[model samples]
Structures are given as structure tokens and as C-alpha cells.
Target: MDEETFNISMRKFLKKVGVTSQQEIEKAIRAGLANGRLKGDEKLPAKMVLTIGGVDLTFAV
Candidate 1:
């Protein structure tokens, strides 16, 4: 892929995933806070798993 095309594609992909993931995380956090499961100032450990075909990746949040 050419530089311009690659940049555009990556930016599009990142924007979509980043926005969706952030919204979902915020919703979950709100639910936890409402149910007394989170104290609002806790450093909680979080994990995310992403798989694409035969490749898998793990991330900490």
C-alpha cells in the first residue's frame, strides 16, 4: 500500500474501534458504579483480547 492509502486506512480503522470500545467501556463503568461494584477511585485491572483469523493479541487497560 502507498503511504497515503495506508495512513488513511489505519486512521479509519483506529477511529472506528477506538470510539466503539470507549463507548462500551464507559457504559460498563457506569453500570458498575450504579450497582456499587466500583468505588470511582479504584485502580482496577482490565484486559482485552482481540483475535483476527489465526492471530490473537492481549492488552492491559
Candidate 2:
């Protein structure tokens, strides 16, 4: 792929993933707050799993 095409596709993919992940996190946080599962000033443990083709990756957030 050309540099221009690769950059455009990468940016679009990253933006979509970033935005959707952020929205889901915010929704979860809101639910936690409503149910008294979380306080406004606490560090929450987070994890994420990603699978691509035959590879699996785990991340700590």
C-alpha cells in the first residue's frame, strides 16, 4: 500500500477503536457509580483482551 493510503487507513481504524472503547468505558463507569460499586476518586483495575487472526494480546489498563 502507498504511504498515503496506509496512513489514512491507520488513522481511521485508530479513531474508531479509540472512540468506541472510550464510550464503553464511560458507560461502565457511570453504571458503577450508580450502583455504589465505585467512588469518584478511586483507581480502578482494568484489563483488555485483543485478538487478531490467531494472535491474542492482553493489556492492563
Candidate 3:
């Protein structure tokens, strides 16, 4: 694939990993919500990643 194609493919792969799509990320940002940028919608056990301060932030919420 070309450079552009590779970049797009990589972006999709990352999104599949953690729902890391541009729109969703942007929505989260606009809502002033940020827990862990790495953790996506439902790729893993959400509860496994405990809170650092005092917030039970789910992957979607």
C-alpha cells in the first residue's frame, strides 16, 4: 500500500483496539471528558483499569 493507505489502515487498527476514532475522541474532548485516551469502548474488562484519583470512568463514558 501507499503511505496514505498505510496511515489510514493504522488508524483503523488503533480504533478497533480502543474505539480510537477521530469523531468519538473529539466528542469526548468537547464534553470535557478524559480518563485514559488509550482505553476504548469495549476491547477489554473496563473495571480492570482502576482509578488513579477518584473516578470510575468507563471506556464509553
Candidate 4:
């Protein structure tokens, strides 16, 4: 495996995930606020799960 190629691919994937996830979260929050389901100043519990081959990881944010 070419380390440079793998690293570049991984970075691209992560960037796409980050950008799309942020957009989705923002849209959801906006909808929730509009519907009176979420207060503007609330701590929201969020979790992210990543699965790849034999690796499975969960992160709480």
C-alpha cells in the first residue's frame, strides 16, 4: 500500500464527512428551533459511530 495515497484518501473522506455532517446538523437544528422542539441554548447530546472492516468505534460529543 502506498502510504501517501492512503493518507490522501483518508483526508478527503474525513473532509467530506465533516462538511456534510455540519450542514446536516445545522439544518436539523434550524428545523427543530422553527418547530419549537429545541431551545436555542441547550446542550445537545450527540454521538458518532464509525465502522470500517473490523474496526468499530463510537464517539460521544
**Highest TM-score scorer:** 4
lDDT of 1: 0.83
Among residues 3 or more apart in sequence or in different chains, the pairs in candidate 3 whose N, CA or C atoms overlap within 3 Å are 18-40
Per residue, candidate 3 scores C-alpha lDDT tens digits across 1-61 of 5999999997886667566455665676655435555444544332223233467544433
Which pairs of residues collide in candidate 1? none
TM-score (C-alpha, index-matched) for candidate 1? 0.67
Error of 2 at 47 (Å): 3.8
The predictions' CA RMSDs to the true structure, in order, are 2.8, 2.7, 15.0, 2.0
Residue 37 of candidate 4: its Cα lDDT?
97
Q: Using Cα atoms with residue i matched to residue i, what is each candidate's TM-score against the true structure?
A: 0.67, 0.72, 0.30, 0.84
lDDT per model vs. reference: 0.83, 0.84, 0.55, 0.88
lDDT of 2 by residue, 1-61 (tens): 6999999998998799889999999999999999999888999777766545556654444
Would you give me the overall lDDT of model 4? 0.88
Give the Å error, residue 16, model 2.
0.7
> Where is model 4 more than 4 Å wrong at Cα?
54-61
Ranking by lDDT: 4, 2, 1, 3
Model 4 vs. true fold: TM: 0.84
Residues 1-61, candidate 1, lDDT per residue (tens digit)? Answer: 6999999998998799889988999999999999999999988776766545556654544
Q: Which parts of model 3 are misplaced by more than 4 Å?
A: 20-61
